[model samples]
Target: GESVGLHLPTLSVQEGDNSIINCAYSNSASDYFIWYKQESGKGPQFIIDIRSNMDKRQGQRVTVLLNKTVKHLSLQIAATQPGDSAVYFCAETPGGGGNKLTFGTGTQLKVEL
Candidate 1:
């Protein structure tokens, strides 16, 4: 996917369908990864998280998958709804980077009715 400089990546899905959002991280040393959902004009809310030691984790209606070897992560949403339409972010905490969280360019999920 192309990063449009300051613009969030987008994933459009029909209401009641499943949605998948993707992200790539540059830090191979990142130990923890979190997925956040942000409604317009609001701070991002925690959706799910996964540790480097785990390849996959599940939450209510959501899932986080980590691919350490490829430095990639993904969020899966089941039965997407209009209320789920929002900007999603993937954040990472490097092994020794203190408490700093590095966020990827967000992905906006638009649920179409």
Candidate 2:
């Protein structure tokens, strides 16, 4: 019951600024994790991921922090840009599945000039 959706379709931001999108996931039994970014109406692109065994994982310009104790997760974007505007989603694959994912709440991001 942790699934959430964006209230607004757009989030206007400057050309250069930090952006943080929020997501809520269900199923505490989920173990694997994944973060994806969708530009416009396109399919989501893989950003970063971490497993329940670890608390955090870092990517080129992204960092994912997970708190298994609270079943919470967050993504940190270092910088903001026009191309960075998109919807971000955090997903999980429960322990019983083989590379299957259950998506979580998604937050839309809009960058303004």
Candidate 3:
């Protein structure tokens, strides 16, 4: 299925501050979740991932949290910088569904000085 384009929501954060981006997924049956960062003129870059079996996962200066009860997901960026400014997207896939992902509408992260 083709994804429909929509105006992305914007999030503004101060440089050197922490930034929290949130997503609400529709599929309760999804077992895998991934967060992506997309810069202008580039494809989405994998930032982090979490499984439904886990509540949280951490990466370099980033963390992904999943709440299965509410079908909610969040990404936290520690000490956000100008380099961290981008459009963030959350994607999910059902268990054993090889390489198929359903993406949520993206949010633009703006790092303010």
Candidate 4:
């Protein structure tokens, strides 16, 4: 058996407030990044993704921002609700033909009423 999530960061937000999650990657050559959200007893679900060539990408109620020079990525959720409570993380893949992806430490998001 493998340990998927032994350690995680945490974010607390009100039901109607927006939530911002931040992640930092170490791979300078990495060219692809994705954000995943996992609910209790569920697998990681794809939230959004951005490529190194892009600075920002937006989705339905969600946005992913990438800063390549600083290796920083952020997920912004608009009007976060209780249903948004979950664990979130970011994954980055290396450049060229590399298929390996590095995942950041998970973050637990708690929605308060």
**Candidate 3, clashing residue pairs?**
none
- Residue 65, model 3: lDDT of 88
Query: For model 4, what is the alpha-carbon lDDT of residue 31?
Result: 86
Cα lDDT of model 2 by residue, 32-59, tens digit: 8888998876999999999989988988
- lDDT per residue (tens digit) for residues 1-113 in model 4: 21122133888999889999988877787889899999999999999999899999999999999987867888999999999999998988877776777787789999999
Candidate 4, after superposition: displacement of residue 33 in Å? 0.1
**Model 2, 41: alpha-carbon shift in Å?**
3.5
Q: In order, how many clashes per candidate?
A: 0, 0, 0, 0
Go through the candidates in order and give each one's C-alpha lDDT: 0.84, 0.75, 0.87, 0.85
Q: How close is every model to the real structure, measured as TM-score?
A: 0.90, 0.81, 0.90, 0.90
Q: Report clash pairs, candidate 1.
A: none
Question: Where does candidate 1 have its weakest 10-residue lDDT segment?
Answer: 1-10
Candidate 3: segments with Cα more than 4 A from true spot: 1-8
lDDT of 3 at 31: 89
Superposed Cα deviation of residue 81, candidate 3 (Å):
0.3
> Candidate 1, residues 2-33: lDDT per residue as tens digits?
22121338888999999988888877788988
